[model samples]
Target: MTKEFFTATPVKQVFDRIVEFVPVGTEKVPTAETCGRILATDVVAQTHLPGFARSTMDGYAVRAAATFGASESSPAYLEITDTVQMGMAAQAPVGNGQAAGIATGGMLPEGADAVVMLEHAAKLDETALEVYKSVAPGANVVAADEDVAAGQKMLAAGSRIRPQEMGLMAALGMETIRVFKKPVIGIISTGDELVEIGQTPVPGQIRDVNTYSLAGTVGQAGGIARTYGIVADRFDALRSTCTRALSETDMLLISGGSSVGTRDLTLEVIESLPDSQILFHGIPIRPGKPTILAKIGQKALWGLPGQIASAMVVFDRIVARFVGHISGNALSYRQHDRITAELTRNLSSVQGRTDYVRARIVEDQGRFYAEPIPGPSGLIRTLVEADGLIEIDMNTEGLEKGETVFVTLLR
Candidate 1:
């Protein structure tokens, strides 16, 4: 069946489209081991934080009214009743004209309203204190539930647990936490021209670059890759491999057949699956325009272009975004920073295809300069020398020197 293709969708639209079809999955894991994973559920406080009115410093805890207006020249002296030890509840309460020796984080005596830090007070004896600095009500103290109230939501579902979240979980005595499960992805490389790496290439055959590059990329994007070794250019063998992969993985990624003749067979194998439907037959991006997307029931199946650099770009842009959605993690590309630069020379691009030109970024004083690295997309040196991509807008004629434009950093 003939299928209609779309002009390249904006990057944002592509992301939203995948997210609409995906939902995060759940897994129970120890909170101690949940670092860097997104939380599956909100973490609510089981009990009051601080749980008591506590002193914030080592000094006198007294009625704020008794110490009001007291200063270095004329200080308020109170009879020291006893000391409140840290981590132990105070046994006695304070009253008028009385003070309690409170250490940092000690439970406050019932009638004390404020604590004077040790730096601002002098101890007269075991029974008396001379306060030089005046303290207001609730000063140098933490009220009950000041940090977190009982049953309050301390963290929300989908939160990316960081060091602070781990510390909070530790403080709450949580040894385990619920998190999203990692998605499983199956990768298959197909081509008669492909041979496993480490084997010397014959005249028309090349090393199996797709399997290793794509497997590593999948791992970095939070999915476990199950690789089915390179399938020869045969319909039955390819179909059986796809069947096995679909049965085992949440998603199947087929490196597209190298020659145009085998492309139809690959699609036919995918279409034979029950309830399978092709989503997109092709994309409108340079070097990767033969990309295909499909759905077998609820599982995603993707066909990537055969060229190495093209395959990597499509996977990084589309497959990685899908993985992030299902795993509840941010997209894998480095955070983008935009800077303007003068084009060193005129660059040509197809009017209808969106192009990602590798460019080197340089800084002079505070201004950023982008110099385009001209090479075929398949060249590894293109990426190695590039700091990031210079997006050539679709329908634009060309870029001329001295025009300021935004270039995104690869790092």
Candidate 2:
């Protein structure tokens, strides 16, 4: 039977297919060990962060009206009535024309709305304070809920846990957090020309690159990478390996399986599996146009290109999205991955294909510029020199010099 091939579909359409793969199970992890995990539940603040209004500077806490018009040339004088020590409650409200000495992080005294920095004020006598600068109400002091307010949602579901999030949760008395279980991603490399990394390849063979590269990429995406050894370019070899990998891992990546010479063999092998269906055969993205996406049940199977550069591009730009999504932190890449930078040189692109140009970032002054690294996708040097990838839209013909573009940073 002649099957209808999935032709070049838009990248947006491909992303819409993400609902086909379900995220893994959720588990409760200690807040200290939750870094890099995807949150399965919203983290709410139970109590006010810091829990008290505190001075941010070591100086005097006084009513703003008491220091009005105070400056280096013309100063204001107030009585130094009391001191608030660190780790102690503030007491003895400052009355009119009165100031209370306080250190950084000391609780603010009642009736005091501002603090004068120590550098901006001095004590002329034991009871007299000379203010050289004026402060407004709410100045130099952080409110009780400045970091996070009680009952507020600090982190939403699908948010990735970073070190900062761990610290914030700990401050709110959260000892444990609910997060998605880390995904297990299986990797396979297919080709008769491939040899083990330990063995020096003979004249016709080359060391396997995709297995290591793809595994590292998977690990960086917060998935546990389980690599299966290389499979030769044969239907039976690929079918058996694919079967085992699919059963063993939550997702599978087959490097070089979708290349020109082995495309049909790989497709046939995938079709033989139970409940297998090809999602797409191609995308309009450059360097990865021949990539294939298939599925058996809820597990996603990616047939990445054979070329080193093309395979890496497809995995990083496209497959990484699925991995991140199944981990429950789908927004991690969408929100934080791309950075805007000015293009250093003009780049021409085909109108129909969305081109991804690898580039080095140049920072001159406080501004950043993307310098395109021109080379074939197969060249390893080009990938190494690139700090990020510049995407040219399918409709756009070219990019002009000094044009600002969003570049997806490499992991």
Question: Which candidate's TM-score is highest?
Answer: 2
Can you write out model 2's per-residue Cα lDDT over 161-259, one digit (the tens) per residue? 889999998999999989999999999999899999999999999889889888888998889999998999888889999999999999999888685
Instruction: List clash counts for every candidate, in order.
Output: 2, 0
TM-score of each: 0.83, 0.87
Best-matching candidate per lDDT: 2
Candidate 2 global CA lDDT score: 0.88
The parts of candidate 1 lying over 4 Å away from their true place are: 1-16, 19-25, 258-264, 328-353, 359-372, 384-411
